[model samples]
Target chain A: MKEIVVVSGKGGAGKSTITAGLSYFLKENDILVDADVDAPNLKILLEPELIREEDFYSGKQFKIEQDFCIMCGRCYQECSFEAIEIVNLNYVIDDVACEGCGLCQFLCPVNAISVSDKLTGKKYVSKTKYGFNMVHALLNPSEENSGKLVAEIKKIAKNLAKEQNSSTIIVDGPPGIGCSTISAISGSDILLLVAESTISGLHDMERLIELTKNFKVKRKGFINKFGLNHSIDEKLVNLFESKEIEIVGYLTYSQNIPQYLKKRVNLPEHIDGYKKLFEGLYNRLMEAVG
Target chain B: MNISIVSGKGGAGKTTFTILFAKYLVSKGKKVLINDLDVEEPNVNLFLNKKLDYDEVYIYIPEHIKENCISCKECAEKCLFNALVVAKDFWLVLPELCHSCKLCEYVCKYSAIKGSKRVIGKIGQSFDKMLHLLEGRLNIGESLTTALIKQVIGKSLKIKDNYDVIIMDSPPGTSCPVIQASKDADKIIVVAEDTPFGFSDFVVLSDMLKEIGKDYYLVINKYIDGEGYSEFASKNNVKVLGKIPYDINLAKNYSFGDVEDIDTIDFDNIYNTLLEG
Candidate 1:
């Protein structure tokens, strides 16, 4: 099976809109994965029906066994994250500050700290109305294991694709060039970035391109809101020319944005121009994967 | 006062609103320091007139000394980030994946694990008498985003007394990096729109802010009719701080990089709540 990851270095560039569109277009013979665990929006568009669910534990956390406390203060000095603190004359570990390092447990002279896996996020395998299987997740608030959760979701998507005998997998990625984006794009066959036509858009897209190149992945892109600024649009195309990233599509802003977004429109069924636009995007994708 | 502008979803105009708010403060004769903590892609400098260049910032990682190796796998097993690998004859440490938490050093009984510096990103600063801008740029393959963001915020706390107000432009999402940026802020302004994705993501961050008990306000950036976000804001007991109408010319000007002295969008409520109040 082939994998395609969609990412944008800048937030609010409409990466979810494009991913939803691609998922609707692919329909069958493909699996969709939402790698944007922090704030997944594809579920807003596709409306997937839950088929399977699982709790994801990436790292470990420590619990203080107060019954066997000595208050030696050695755990406090040995802690790397400063999670160990004495509150109200009682030793406790702040859940927010803990990195799940398990060092406090090992260094506890009284063995008062016990290490256990922490629940950071949840994963779901669902079926969309379009007859496509989807894998998505939601990282709990203030959770830091998003990179691991992303990798886990992608692994499930790959296994589901193999079981269903599908030939393609599309990933909706999180914005930024951090660990989560890297996990989404690391081994993907195709990278498609949807960049807006603004100054910040170009700047963030340059960073995205640099990140993709670091992973040795050739990225192709589409410019959202092309007519907003002709000069900047040309500069974007010129930058693509310089970087050797092909420009496969250009999408313009329309009045139906709010109207369409309100409906969570993923399919191009109602929009006239999008049918052709999605076809063009899919065609370029097919060509690249082939 | 240091206020951080954050959003759970991307393209919600965090950078746009931050720059506009900074400009408004400068016009009001308040010394401002704007720090862009979105090290993954620092783009606030794109709107500035001067060239943006950053000095390299490095983080500590453990480099294994083979002669002192006992191969007990203690360091490898106790690592918090799973960055170390132990083979029968060799050790592999992935520097890019390290969190620089230094847990490996504490676990080592011997002094085989040596602390070393690796370039993580670049931190840039530009200033005049009135407005100062500091930006963090993470190296392309670097994974230590929260560390660099913390460094920028940590340093900002030291020299913040020199400026009347400091505005932190945070990265997208409600994760570690965004939390790190918001933890130190006096107040947070979440930039969002009146859409489903925007509403849900805003609620996510709002819940987090409420849970953490941090002072925060909501700003609607691209409000068409304010149907979805307004409902969410009212339901959540959050005060609506400001609103920017969805206008094509404003977007065009932003695209063309011409956001100087243009008062197309009114930020009066925001100014009153954040500055005057």
Candidate 2:
């Protein structure tokens, strides 16, 4: 099966909207995955019903055994993160501050600190209202293991695609050139970037393109809000021209799109011209993947 | 006062607000330092249009000294990030996967693992009149975002006393990086667009903020007469600072990187209210 991942280096550049549109257009042929585990929003567009759920534990967390009471501040001094803090006069590990590096546990002379598997997030297999299987996850707020969670979700999506004999997997990726974004795009057949026509958009998209150079995947794009700035649009087009990335689509600046999204209406189904636009996006995607 | 402009989702106008507010402070002849903590894809310098002095930032990763005789897998076994691999004859340390925790160096019984510096990104600073811009940019293909952010914040904290107000542009989402950026802020201004994804992520972030007991206010961007965000802010007791009307010209100006005197909202009032109250 082929995998197509949608990502935007800048946030709110319409990655989810494009992913939702692509998934709707692909229909039964594609299994959907939302790799933005921190804030999964494809569920808002697709309206998936939970079919299977699983708890994801990826890293280790150090827990202080309160019964073993040696107040040696060795662990506190050696702690690089300062995760070990005194709360109510008891040396406790601040869950938020802990990086799960297991240094405190190793340095604990009294063997008071023990390590346990950290439940970083939860993954779900759902059946969308539009009749496609979707694999998504939610990284527990403040969890740093989003890259692992994204990799796990992609694995599930790939397995589901194999089981269902689907020809494609459309992934909605997170914003940025961080670990999670890297995980989402790696090993994908195609990388569909949704960039906005803004100065920051061009700047961020440049960084993302720099990131994608390390991966051996086909790069394609749609410049969202194209008419917002004609100069930036021209610059984006010129940049796309310089790079190997193909500009397959351009979405004009629209005020009504956000309004429609706020109401949870499918763009292609409700909007008059979006049907053709998304159809073009899907067609270009198929041609590239093929 | 340290003010952080954050967004629940990407592209929610955090940078836009940050530059606008920084310029506003500059107009009033206040010493303003803008910290762009969005290391992964920092774009605050795009609007600055000024020459910035650059400094390379590095993270330490363990380098295995191959000739140290023993093949004890203690370092590999104890490594939480699984960055180290021990083979029969060779050892591999994936620098990209390393969290720079120095655990491997500490765990090695033999003096085989030594810490070495690897360049992660650079911190750029532009002192343009009253406005100072400090941007942290993570090297492409590098995942150590929070490490660089910590460095940026560390530098900001050292010289923050010279500035009247320090405005930080935090990366989007409610994750470790966002939390790291918000942890040091005196107050946070959350920028939200009035869309479903925006509203949903905002709810998630606000809940996390409340759990963390962070003092934060909401500013609606590209607002289109929407009561959903305002109602939720009221219901959740979150302060709604101001709303930026949906103006294509504002977007256009931002796109052109010419935000010198673009006054879309009452940034002065917002700053005064946040600082005083």
Candidate 3:
């Protein structure tokens, strides 16, 4: 089995739109994984029927007992995260800022602080409307450690692929070259960078290419929304060529694209050229991965 | 006062709106300081044609002292982020995983660990008279986004007296970095594009803002004819700040890094509305 992960360092560059379209065209039995835990939108396109969900726990959070607490202020003084804040004359942990480092628990002289598992987010396994098993995660807003959730969902998708004898795993990765993007790229056979033909898109894609150098994964570039500017599109194509990345295909600009996406309609049926574009891109991807 | 421009969906014109609004404020005789908190990409500098003086930003991670090593695995065990690994034969440090919590240095009994500053990103600032720009740009492959944002914001606050308003262009998404940038903002403007994926992510951002008790207004970028943003706003009781119409020329100008004042948004009216109470 092979994993083909799609990432665009800049968001709203048609990563999910392309991924959903290609999933419909790929002939192989594939499992879909949405690695954008902070903003998972693959499910919005390929509506999923949830099979199971479970609480995902990672690290630890400290809870201070109000009765046993003496406001010694030691935890506040020692916490590097500044997570311990005084609220209504009571010391409370700001879960958003808390890094769960256990420094506060160790520094508390009153023994009022107790450590418990931090409920980070939820993991879901479902059957997508595209007839593929999907695994995705939703990290609570303002939560850290999104990379962990991405890795978790990818792992679950891999195991499910193994059980169901799937051939390919299509991952819709998050924006930015952050921890989550790194996690999504890990162990993937081919990293398909879905970039748009704009200056910012080109600049962000360059940063993402720098990131991919750390891994030995084969890279493919597909410029979405191409033809917006001939100069910018040429610049993007030159970038892909200079980086030795294979250019799979390009999708020209379309106003109807967003309209179709807004209505959650399948793109192949409504969008003018996306049907042929995705089919050719899917074939090229399978060829590259193999 | 600090007002941050953010959109959950990137490439949804957060940076474009920030540049245009900053120029608008300057035209109105408001000394504006623009803080580009989108460190991962930092596109504000692209549109602003100015030479900036840059200062390197660093984070201190535990540097192992190989000469003083007793190979006691205490420091590795104490590391919450698992950035350090010490065995009898070898020791390693993955700087990317290091959170810079200083726990490793604190736990080392034999002085086998020392704090060392590594350059993770840089802050660039330039004052063009009334319009001051401070931007944070993370080095490629670096993951410490929130740390750099915090430092850039700290520096911006120090020089806050020079400007009448500090407008922060926050990073996209409703994540840790976004939370850190929003922590100090007096008002937040969420730019939501009129698309399905855009609205989906916008709803997520709105939920996060509500959870954090931030007073935010929405601006529909690339506004279409029959979108649900207005209805969603009324249902959620969020104020509609202003909408930038969907113009292909605006997008074309953005692609070329040109910032010309367009009649698409009535910035003066929005400014008046923002000033109320």
Candidate 4:
């Protein structure tokens, strides 16, 4: 099966809107993955029904056995992270502060500290109204290992696609050029970059484009809110042409989007021209992916 | 005092605010040290038109000595991250997956395993009269950001007590890096816009700060261009430090590296409120 990832350098660039519309346009049984584990909103638009949920754990946490504690204060001093703190008379480990580096566990003369797995987040597999599978996750607040969660979500999507004999997988990736974005784009057949028309937007897009090039993935560009600045839009078009990246389409500023977002409804149905625009974009994307 | 300019979401003017804040402090005759903790994309240096002086930060990972190796497979079994793959003749280590826990070395029965250091990223520092900007740049294709952030923050700690005010520009999201940067702060100013996205992320960030026991104030940016953020702030009982109206000239000048005068605008009031808070 082929996969396409939709990513933007900055937030609020209509990445989820486009992903939801495309998911609606794709044939039934296709898979949709929301790799934005932090603050995932694709389900709000797609309105997926819960099918299954599983807890995911990436790293371990250090726990000290109080009975064996000697109040040596060695763990506090040796910990590179100030995960340990003195509460009352006993030392306690702040699970959030603890990096699970094992230095405290190894250095404890009393062998009081031990590492155990902690739940980081939960992943969901659901059935959307469009008759497709949706795989997404919500990382716990102040949790780490988002990139690992992204990988797990994609793995589940791939397995679901195989089990259902689906032919395509579309992913709504997170913003920023971080480990999570890299995990979402890795091994993808195509990447759709949705960039805004602002100076900082252009600069962030440059960094994201450089990042995508490192993975050697085929890329296409779309200028979201093209009406923000006409000159910047022209400059972006030229930049795409110079880089040999195709400018698939442009989306002008529209209140209909935020309206749909507020109501948690799909765009194509609520907006007047969004359906046609997305249908055409979907067809073109299929052709390009082929 | 160490102050951090942070937002829960990306592109919310963290770097822009840092530069302008540095210029404002310099004009006020206060020495400032700006540390950019957004190691994944260190763009503060780019805006300043200065190259970073790089110093390597190393992380230890297990390496097997072939001569002393035993085919026991104990190291692989003890590895929780699945970083060690035991083969018939030897074991292979996946450096990226390794959390540098040193468990493989401890579990080795043959004394074959040894820990070695690898440079995951570098700490870069540059200085002006009023500002000493330090940034950590994680090497491309490297996934270990928390380690690099720790190194950068550790190095900055030595000189942080000297400066009158050390301003830190943190990475987006309430993850490990954000916690690391905000851990030692005297106070935090969360810069957010008046939008659903901004408000939602602000709640998440506020919860994080409260859990970590840090004192914080909120600044609603682009308030003149929109509304709703104030309502959210009031309903949540988040202290309002200040507000910056939506101004194209301010944004343009900031993008071009000309620090717009915060005193000429309402930002000075915002800074004063934060200082008071």
Model 4 lDDT tens row, B121-152: 88887755567888887776688888888788
Give candidate 4 misplaced runs (Cα > 4 Å): A9-14, A43-51, A71-82, A101-111, A126-133, A163-165, A214-216, A225-243, A252-276, B109-111, B224-228, B246-259, B262-265
Could you arrange the candidates by DockQ from highest to lowest? 2, 3, 1, 4
Let me know the TM-score candidate 3 reaches against the reference structure.
0.97
Candidate 1 C-alpha lDDT tens digits along B1-277: 8898998878788888888888888888989999989889888878876565567887788888888888889888877777899877688888866766777877788787888988888888885658888889898877878878877887778889899989999988888778888876888999987788988898888877877788678888777777777667677677778778787777787887666544555666577777654
The C-alpha interface RMSD of every prediction is 1.6, 1.1, 1.2, 3.3
Model 1, position A210: C-alpha lDDT score? 80
Every candidate's lDDT: 0.83, 0.86, 0.86, 0.78
Misplaced by over 4 Å in model 1 are A214-218, B51-53, B260-268, B275-277
**Per-prediction TM-score, please?**
0.95, 0.97, 0.97, 0.87
A113-146 per-residue lDDT for model 1 (tens digits): 8877888889999988888989999998887879
Could you give the CAPRI-style class of model 3? medium
DockQ score for model 4: 0.29
Candidate 2 Cα deviation (angstroms), residue B260 = 5.2
The model with the greater lDDT, 1 or 2, is: 2
Q: Model 3 segments beyond 4 Å from truth?
A: A270-272, B66-69
Candidate 4 per-residue lDDT, tens place, A21-57, comes to: 8888767788999998876767766778999999998
The worst-scoring run of ten residues by lDDT in candidate 2 chain B lies at: B258-267
Worst 10 residues of 2 chain A by lDDT: A21-30
**What order do candidates take by TM-score, descending?**
2, 3, 1, 4
Model 2 iRMSD vs. native: 1.1
